[model samples]
Target: MTKHHITLAGAAAIAIAVAAPVALAQDATVAKRVDKLEKEMRAVQRQVFPGGAPAFFEGEIAPDATPGQVVKSNSPVADLTARVDALESQLRALTGQTEQNAFQLRELEKQFAAYKAEMDKRVPPAAAGEPAATPASLPVVAAPRPAAPTPAPAATATPPKKPATPPAASAGKPDAARLALVKKVEIPSSGNEQQDAYDYGFRLWSAKLYPEAQAQLKTVVAKWPKSSQASYAQNLLGRAYLDDGKPSLAAVAFYNNYKDRPDGPRAPHSLMYMGIALDKLGRKADACKAFRELDEVYGTKAPQDVRTDAAAAKAKAGC
Candidate 1:
């Protein structure tokens, strides 16, 4: 009877050992699956929130859970399910925010396009093949005639005859010589044909038609070299080249204006713009020299606007 009892015990021990390995294998498989799920959750969190996963969903110990005590479930499946639920909630929130940002970006792009269209309308392109109008020539006046000599009064005449009123003055006409001189030296008229031509070019410039404006202004400058508007046309021609991204050409135009008419009203402005064009060309040293010359020559004589612009340009160039 004692042998029989020992045999039964040995057989039970072998069975128990076999069952223990099977249970351990099942547990290992579950642990591996749980690890995989956790890794997937971390990847999702990284995509959703680049800064970091939220503290609440990061598997931190609950405030009420005591130190050294496990708050998670003993079953790995249950723990994984809970983590997945938290990740799903975070993903929903992140997706909504991303959509909102995308919508805002699209709206901003539309606004920018509309603004550009409106600006384009304000500066319409010049019509093709339209000829520029010619200015009318100034009228010439003839030189005054010499006055007739008065005959000597008779000795017997009791009273000198009153001096006869000049025929030209009596007719209310000005002296021809004086009129001619006045017309030659008169200030430019704003309503004259020359001014109108310049205005047409100025309108082209306002519309950002740099090529057309440059051509028109050149014609005005060449045709009316002695006109008061010559300085203005030359200065604006330089600006056209500058605005059209031809800084080298703009520098030449500006320099010419300054050199040709240093004391003209637009000379200081031309010098200031020359500095700006040189700076754009990466010739900062030449730009600084231009600015210095402007200040040295014009000083307080420069217009307030020109001086202000020069100062700003100088500061930007570190001059």
Candidate 2:
């Protein structure tokens, strides 16, 4: 015989002998596992599908069954359950690992999509019903609003010796002094923010920057018509006009202010100032009406000093 053939025979003999015992042991283990699975399955089956009543022997010639009939009827429910349970356990162990691996793969895909999004600034946002993002896409920024309007003056009036009054509000290139005043004079906070506007307005008025202050305060009243300070700002704006030698603008301010906030705390002042400003504009009927409104609204509450001063103006204006 050839040396290769002899070697081949030796290896084959060893492999068969070793494989035989191992195979037998594996079969025995499988059988034992199957039996154990059967017992557990039968216990569960009894709880779920217990058959009806048992028969027993009566003492005196009764027609009933004796013990050991469980085997005679070929009741194989426990055996069937055990066989099914053993197969299911093997199936679950094998398939459960594969299912877990699939879940991990899906989670990794999600992480990759998020990582791609963070790096791309130009990518559009995800839309409703849209597919998930991939590495090729990025993010985007939103558009901004139009530029804010040029700030108006705090008060409304013309400059000294200026016959024509310039537009108080400008678009792109606004007046420097007016803008400066607007930035410096923020509308104050209050229950009646209009009144806060007016009070700050008064501080501006006392400073003698009447036109700018009037415009700013007037804006507060215009923006918040319901504000308690609406009338105050309006009336003060009228006064600012009169001080600036513009009776027409003053009349407009006072009239607008009074009409908007009739019961305002500054109503009396508004009415009185409108009468004075209108009287200066040679509008007598308009002036008298304003004076009468002042008298009617502020009967007792009108300060004696204010009434006296208004009375003097009315007499001077022939209202």
Candidate 3:
């Protein structure tokens, strides 16, 4: 009987040892599932709140509720069910929040697009090639005409006499007053037409009448493009603009002179002045390029005065 009792005890001990390993394996499987669920929760949080997870979200999953903690559950299934329920509830909340944020952003974009359309209608775009008309460019409103005097009685009538005033200049014509100003500045004529036109422009430029000089020089270039005076006129036109505080226009004029008449007598002068104009327009790098080009293109052929000025300019520009 004692042997039998001892044998029974040994069998029971073996059974207990086998059960322990199975229970441990089940616990390990549950832990892995819980870890996977936690990782999925974190990924959802990142997608929902791109900036960062909120404070409440960071602390939402209680440490004591984790699978690592000893939960008083009747079975592993019950523990897994509780954990899945919690994750599903949080996931649903995050999904709703993401949808709400996307809706708000789309609505904002629509509102902005509508407002832009309204503004565009109110302020029409400018026509191609034409600048928007400013207040100064608007046409003047004419004064209302007075009612004609009641016609005189036939017995007392006298024929209407013409007014003794000079006829007004026609519309779209050059102003007579401006022409009179041009005529006032006298320039002695040369036998050569090209020379005479350039001399008149030069005289106007010397007198500090930059607008008139620009117009006159343009005329000289237009009328005698093949003449020797064309080079001088183009260079002087650039100088006129430069002296009038229009460095931008001056730079263009100088570039045209050199590009169109490279072999002309004043080509080097134009290139030098182009550099100075670019410098005045606050373009140091472009100025350096111009100076470098002047050296490369003209070398010793450039006038002494131009080379000296270019050297000074390069130093000033730190080139």
lDDT of each: 0.58, 0.52, 0.61
Model 2 Cα shift for residue 246 (angstroms): 1.7
Instruction: Provide the lDDT at 239 for model 1.
Output: 76
| Candidate 3 local lDDT, 15-130, one digit each (tens) | 99998896776677567656656765776666665558353244234443434434456786557757766876777788788879889999977975674464245323321001
Q: Candidate 1 lDDT (Cα, whole model)?
A: 0.58
Ranking the candidates on lDDT from highest down gives 3, 1, 2
| TM-score head-to-head 1 vs 3, winner | 3
Off by over 4 Å in 3: 1-181
- Tens-place lDDT per residue, model 2, 21-48, is 9655545544555554445444434433
Residue-pair clashes per candidate, as listed? 0, 18, 0
How far does residue 155 in candidate 1 sit from its true spot (Å)? 67
lDDT score of residue 155 within candidate 2: 35
Q: Under the 3 Å rule for N, CA and C atoms, how many clashes does model 1 have?
A: 0
Q: What is the lDDT of residue 198 in candidate 3?
A: 63
- Candidate no. 1 TM-score: 0.41
Q: Find the candidate with the highest TM-score and give its number.
A: 3
